[model samples]
Target: IQHALSGLGYAAVKGVRQGKFFVLNLDGWGREEAQKQLERISKEVLTNPVIEEYRFEIVD
Candidate 1:
């Protein structure tokens, strides 16, 4: 998809990667707190730090 789009003149969108997605349900946490928790969870459990990488964003 990335190659096809780039071939069609998409300069702004490049290096597209496909990955998995997961939605966790948590309650009572604000943006700042949720961010910290997500970071910790992502680093410690969600990804293998050595071979894999992960990122998260709040959708709600």
Candidate 2:
């Protein structure tokens, strides 16, 4: 797809990436606690640090 895009004159298409997006809902947690738990979950459970990456956002 990157090559095809470039062929179609999208010269700025230097790379293409694919990944999953997730929306998680947590109940009754404060922002600081949510951030800490999310960091732990992302690092130890959700993704592999060697090849994969993850991020999370907390919303009301």
Candidate 3:
């Protein structure tokens, strides 16, 4: 997951004791677009159905 995010230009500054954080600089893209892109990336790259599952929420 960390590797996938890093490849997409997000910096995984913290990933051990506190789970993970991918710091992304989405230049000027709107929140909705960014969220959609991240969702695709997570589904296609970050997750392996044989081993992992995830759920998320957007708080705004």
| Candidate 2 ranges with C-alpha deviation above 4 Å | 4-12
Model 3 is weakest, by summed lDDT over 10 consecutive residues, at 13-22
Q: Which one is best on TM-score? A: 2
Structural RMSD, model 3? 12.3
| Model 2 global lDDT (CA atoms, 0 to 1) | 0.86
Please give the RMSD of candidate 2 to the true structure: 1.8
Clashes by residue pair, model 1? none
Each model's TM-score, in the order given? 0.63, 0.74, 0.43
Looking at model 3, the pairs that clash are: none
Clashing residue pair totals per candidate (backbone < 3 A): 0, 0, 0
Give per-residue lDDT, candidate 2, residue 51: 97
lDDT of 2 by residue, 1-60 (tens): 899999999989899988987777888778999899889988887888899977787777
Candidate models: Cα lDDT each? 0.87, 0.86, 0.63
Worst 10 residues of 1 by lDDT: 13-22
- Tens digits of lDDT, candidate 3, 1-60: 666667778785445232443444566657798789878776787776576665545444
Give the runs in model 3 whose Cα sits over 4 Å from its true position: 1-21, 55-60
What is candidate 1's local distance difference test score?
0.87
